[model samples]
Target: MNALEKLKILGESAKYDLCNYVSPNLETYASGKIPGVYNSTSPDGHCMPLFKVLMTNKCSNDCKYCMNHSNRKFERYEYEPAELSRVFMDYYNKRYVEGLFLSSGVFKDIDSSMEKQVEVARILRDYGYDGYIHLKILPGTSYDLIKRAMSLADRVSVNIEAATPDGFEELTTTKNFKTDILKRMKWISRLSNDKNMAPSGQTTQFIVGAADESDEDILKRTNWLLDKFKIKRSYFSAFTPLENTPLENYESPHPKRTSRLYQADFLLSYYGFSFDELVFDENGNIETEVDPKYSFAMNNMDLFPVEVNEASYDELIRVPGIGMVSAERIITLRKRGLKIGKLEDLKNLGVAVKRAEPFVKLNKSYQSVLSF
Candidate 1:
């Protein structure tokens, strides 16, 4: 197949490796006028068009949930490093995308696969295309190649498909959880000690529900990654079974599972929440109907009706509807000697009043009844 045809397949295959926490309701790609262009959301909530595609769809690894699994019988293809760099420049010159996100399956060996991707980044850099680039570090990639990739790209990641050893064993027999994945992540962390390597930092992803792992299991792993690697972020992709694969008959998790994971992840990453502070059901899964922060508030009603004007930044962020931005606004206005004496004042500052009402007091006057 030609480069464009290969991109259509490889690009679709790359979608399973998410770079950000995108909601299901949002469109992830451009309106089909062009192929390989993806609407990737940034950490700060800005959407930038990225030329996201795989270098190849041929694989030697047997990741059961993957469409490009080694056992799958289908047309396979790969792009020459220079060919992909040229195509990306075509998109870049036209202003169609702001950056490039390159990933690949293990075509022959892990290092060879990583080399092809790094070569593409190298070609782009050689051509003076100094824009954003994110390269996927294939599991088991050599430490030196990872350091080289870090030098060329702004961000890099490895998909830690499952949380535990046994859980990983259930997914694929061809890869090792600790040696192939975690050890490589450690190398990325260590190599990252130099400020010039992947300044945007490293990230990782997990396949939700494929290993029969619970939400609690996923969050614990995320917490561990944050503490150990100080990773820039973690992404959760809800498992969707595909045809003719080993997991073809397996059921997909509720869509809300990944969404709830993102919400809870934000709380852990930004809202000053500890894993033990989170509320979970008997099954160790977060609530699908109610968001995690709201559930936390509802579970501990004793902390409700906190005086907004008097609450500390930490305390204000824990409130159900008050986010980091709004909490900062409250503190900023408070320092200016402005008192939030009414619900409308909180609303003007971007607080979700309906959600925050029951949990906050305006100038010590309770705002809403505890209907629950």
Candidate 2:
């Protein structure tokens, strides 16, 4: 097949893996703007840029949720080590991309497949290609192979597709539970902490709505991963059923629910909210109408109207709309001794006080009462 045809077949087959990383534009940076200073039409639109790409779509495992599994009758293709390196370099040379994100479907056994991935990365590095490279470290691979892969790639990931042991067994039938996946994550975590290791760090993806797992179960596992492994990020892919797969008839998760889980993950990482606080009931599913922060404020009415000047950082973060940035601003601005008589004062400093008022006290007065 031609290059275009090969790309079509490869990209189509790889889409079922559900890994996504979007690149950012550097228009503001070109003008010599300082880092962390973002220019956006709206205040909330500021974020750093990234670049992402898939590596290959060949596999030996029969993951039920994956379209490129060995049992599935789909067109298969594998980019040779040199060909993959050339493609990435071509993109980089033309300034069409910023980095390479390489993942595969286990074309051979874990060791051989991982070796091939490392070979591609080695070629790029030897050619002096300096850009971000995120590689997927397959489960059951040797510790030595993982170490080698980590040495060349900037970021590494191992997906734990299911939340529970039974859920993992149901999805990927042949893999061992804790021994194969969790053990590798533990090793990666250890390696990342070492000062000489790659600086970008490690991340993982969990397939939501593929099996019978509540949001609470997923968040609980995420908390465990973060505490135990010091993971940089945990990605949640809303499970999309593929044709001819065993789970083709399964119901997919609502997109809004997936978005809320990401929001909840942020709350857990930065705002000190527990998985239990984000959930409405014992099952741990977030309310669909509002995000978890708003839900938390509405439920804990007793904590509202906290004094902005005197409230501690922990207390300020619990408020419905106040994020880490706004909380710091509130603390810093209060020290200036400005006469903050009303909620509108926060608007000048770019704080969303409309959402904060119900949960904050201004100048020792509870200006707004919680409705629920």
RMSD of every prediction? 1.5, 5.6
Model 2 segments more than 4 A misplaced: 12-51, 369-372
TM-score per candidate, chains pooled: 0.97, 0.88
Clashes of each: 0, 8
Over 240-274, each residue of candidate 1 has an lDDT whose tens digit, in order, gives: 89998899999999989888998998899988899
Query: How accurate locally, in lDDT, is each candidate?
Result: 0.89, 0.72
C-alpha root-mean-square deviation, candidate 1: 1.5
What would the TM-score be for candidate 2 when compared with the true structure? 0.88
lDDT of 1 at 26: 58
lDDT of 2 by residue, 286-349 (tens): 7767888888877777777677778888898887777788778888877887646777876665
